[model samples]
Target: MGGKTVASLRNRADLLKFDYTHLYGKGHRRPVIAAVTDERLRELVLQSRSWNHLAQGLGYAASNTKDTGWRPRVEARINALGLSTEHFQGRGFNGLAPLAHEPVFTADPTPERLRVAATGKAIAWFSERGYTVSLPVEPAVYDLIVDSPNGLDRIQVKSSAAADRGVHCSRTLYDTTRPGSASTGRYTRRPYEPGEIDYFFIVMADGGMYLLPYEVIGRSMKITVGARYEQFRV
Candidate 1:
């Protein structure tokens, strides 16, 4: 994305600037399907704007990368609480929303659904592990909040999935919306004004619920079967 922007379907003439797009086919006038074949070229094409662009074209704010010294502790919590991807499914968020559970929605039947299911599962799963789950919190209908047993330790919930690889992944984002701020962080809203939460989590379902760090999945994060997990402290 740095210097590789491409024109839309109608403005493909710009592609002729590169010899890479015309490896197999004789001329650049042919469609890419007939022109490109080499793996490297294919990778370039794959990494091309349209190929890696998120299924959902939403823009995202960069996550705070400063380590918060919480990884070892969080990992320990995950281990002690048995928060594996497999265990945090179906029932993880059940305690918070009880009767009103939202199933992962997707246009196609793919692993994205599993990621959605796993996210909901992580909420309920954490709650069952003694964490408190809160949902439909005021100001944001799509928001879910999780409170760790340590009392004040809280995590805001947000889920994402990409069917490209048949997997679903969800991550917790820090809410940076405080009163009177020009804008909020990835998960904060203007209504909260200067309101912000310190820590964030990213959970995905490759095989089960793996809690990832917010930074790893920040920009254009997509859910896929083989998507790797990234973790950030604080």
Candidate 2:
């Protein structure tokens, strides 16, 4: 392989064998390695140059280290942006940007868990009100399970700053029927049935909160472009 070809293979190897148990702790041994598309990865590679400039205002570093306390907070912020960070492992360059080692945050461990925890907190927040929530006996790994005296509420929690962008929606609205991008679609699509859940509670990463009507989220998906901050209008 030529120099560039060899380097590309090395980067791919590093991505597959990237280790993070040292920083995130033993609890993060098995992380989900999301298969991003070549286009997306290329876009990220290009954006990595500007990420440092963007991340600084967001309180993130351009590199990963044991010292940066920003990992947890950055993870939380990404969750608010509607991107699945449940699989974030850490943040650092994958060696594919303008700089030999630009900063790229790993999400296999950071973003996804925060979303689950936030959702759980939102659900528990409602359960504490003496509702009839059951914690979802089916165990769909949802954020919250709230059984109100009047009805039931299945909630997914999210946290985001004023800068993150992108929002996903589906037509069926059922967990099994959610739409996905065929170009880079690697996750299991789900159906988003509105009748199944009474409400979608979106807790903002910036301490703002909203009750998204099921109908609104189930009808369509939205992507934020050329912007930094956005709120889900339900």
Candidate 3:
């Protein structure tokens, strides 16, 4: 005689298959299906409620990947979160998932490239003006320190994908937006302040750079860089 059917076995055990593509894209490992531990299961249970939010938390696209190889695991989570799994394949959700999705963030696709190019240009600009540059071993409040004939100046290097506007200078806003939950994080403009940074060094998407003093800017978020601010361009 044969053993119990698949549905019966699943009902008797915590045997759900998760693709784990959300963690690592595909082909890195074989047999994505595996039994999750109770602890891991608990953490997953506490994750964002809405499917869109869950996808955001997973760092994956929600509109797609619904009928993926291991959607059963997602179904398990959806069920646990009290969401109906019907029509999960479609954009139209017959059920709304939980609500703990992380803040959706937009990042430059090639920030490292911009950083390297901009840093090189900044070094050249400073060297031409008779300044010695020192890079930090461990990144801190500032990425570099400059020793000029005038004096020492501490600099914070910021890179942005935006070429049309200045880069974002942000600070986390607390005790304002969401009242109860701290999971919701909000980023706002935090202008350069005296004693915090002597200069704001910015690198734009097109490899353009600016080395502006703190006095030039006010106590507002965004440090404008372009033709007007290009006087300080490196």
Work out candidate 2's RMSD over C-alphas.
Answer: 23.9
Give the lowest summed-lDDT range of ten residues in model 1.
53-62
Q: Candidate 3, clashing residue pairs?
A: 49-97, 49-98, 49-99, 50-97, 50-98
Report how far residue 47 has shifted in candidate 2, in Å: 59
**TM-score of structure candidate 3:** 0.41
Candidate 2 Cα outliers beyond 4 Å, as residue runs: 1-113, 141-143, 158-166, 169-191, 223-234
Write one digit per residue (lDDT tens) for candidate 1, span 1-234: 222343352245545553544322223222533333344343432332321121011111112112223234333433554444332224223212133556656466455465456446657666778777676546642345666544543344443454353322233445655445445434532221123342234343333444443344433334443424422211
* 1-234 per-residue lDDT for model 3 (tens digits): 123564364455545663333342334212322344444544554654444444444444455436354556656655676754342344554235545787677665575577567667677777788788888798555666899756878877767776456666643345456446555554334555667677877778775777777777645566556677879886
The prediction achieving the highest lDDT against the true structure is 3
Instruction: List the global CA lDDT of all models.
Output: 0.39, 0.46, 0.59
Ranking by TM-score: 3, 2, 1
Instruction: Give the C-alpha miss distance for residue 114 in model 3, angstroms.
Output: 2.2
Global fold similarity of model 2 (TM-score): 0.35
Which of the numbered candidates is closest to the native, going by highest TM-score? Answer: 3
